[model samples]
Target: MPTQILKEQLAISIRMLERANHIDFNGHMSTRVPETDFILINSAAVSRSTITADDVIMIDLEGNVIEGNGRPPNELPLHTQIYKRRKDVQSIAHTHPRWSTMFTIANIPLRPVVMQGAVLGEIPVFPKSQSISQQEIAEDLAEKLAGHHIILLKAHGAVVTGTTIEEAFVRSVFLEENAYRQYMASQLEYAHSLEDEDIQKTKNVVWQPNNIRKIWDYHFSKL
Candidate 1:
């Protein structure tokens, strides 16, 4: 089982995503326990709107529930395979942000336009729209997402990974913001992506500890 702090953090993030409008009903988040093969994930059956620390379940890399109540999300592989492939990733969030899905559905490349979006880097789209339930499909998508921060599932949702739960939560929020801005800009004809030099410079401040905490604290304050 995860510590009380970990459970609280996961529960808070679920509420954070919900408050940001990043997820409604079919969303999930998970964190890898440090120095172990264990993971703490939110229950799929638990309503994100009313999630509590007790709703978090512990599962190993193989998806077996080690503690807590309720089942992990059906898209467990969406999280497990990635944790296996990316040693750098400590947390993951699966969300169905409207604008981010629009980019995938319309085949429009979602580029970094806002300063905070520079942290997202180049996002790839998984070829399929169906639920990522099978191990094989999850493994393939993991390979496709191995070197990226986020991947959009065609006509579905997005999977976001971060070095910390805070980063993942913020990136998920920014993904939708940047996408909506790009969409609105495209209507006029000039939706220029952030220049490479600009992206390089902006990322330095965007990922700063204080800034990240500011975002996390802001959301936590709301709830």
Candidate 2:
């Protein structure tokens, strides 16, 4: 797909995710080209459900607006920081997913409750600096997201990265599902959690992009 079309679809998906309750007013999403520093990201204050394709703003790696008219999300630094830190990533989706936020508030590093919940590696939690300044947040997130694709913001939300917007969205959706399920099971008193071996097996199986592509295509195609 052409870059322009992909940008539009990404924006539309952001809106759909928000409308479908995968996101709320407080979160943000971003996508970028493989070789360039330019990125497409959601703006601030606009309800994600009402955002149009044109509403997606473009910015340089340094967070300067290069296209579109709207103000970028306050978390723009978070997006650019990820792009700079991980060259393999082309998209980053941040959301205040209800369940993930619950774990975040409790300072819980999510354990693998099921096959999909397993983080192949450790998912880190950043201190609640909540710095609105570009320099501060970028440096903080870089330090926080050292070894994984998913990172929880203490008392805030989670950030997910992928090679594409669809990939990021699907991962974000499942992460929230895992978080919620774990929370519900915790309440059940006798809910059985995955064994260490099972967790490792699931981690190995689900960590690859190749493993998730068909699933990503199936759902993203519907949009």
TM-score of each: 0.97, 0.86
lDDT score for candidate 1 against the true structure:
0.91
Q: TM-score of predicted model 2?
A: 0.86
lDDT of 1 by residue, 1-223 (tens): 3477888899999998998888998899999888889999999899898899999999999999999998999999989999999999999999989999998888989989888778888899998999999999999999999789999999999999999888899888788889999999999997889999899789987888899889899889999
* Least well predicted 10-residue stretch by lDDT in candidate 2: 129-138
lDDT of 2 by residue, 21-124 (tens): 76877678889954577988877867787777777888898888898887888777888877888887888888777787777788766876777777534678
What pairs collide in candidate 1?
A: none
Clashes of 2: 0
Off by over 4 Å in 1: none
Which segments of candidate 2 are over 4 A away from where they belong?
Answer: 129-133, 190-192, 203-223
Scanning candidate 1 in windows of ten residues, the lowest lDDT window is 1-10
Name the best candidate (by lDDT): 1
For each candidate, C-alpha RMSD in Å? 1.3, 2.6
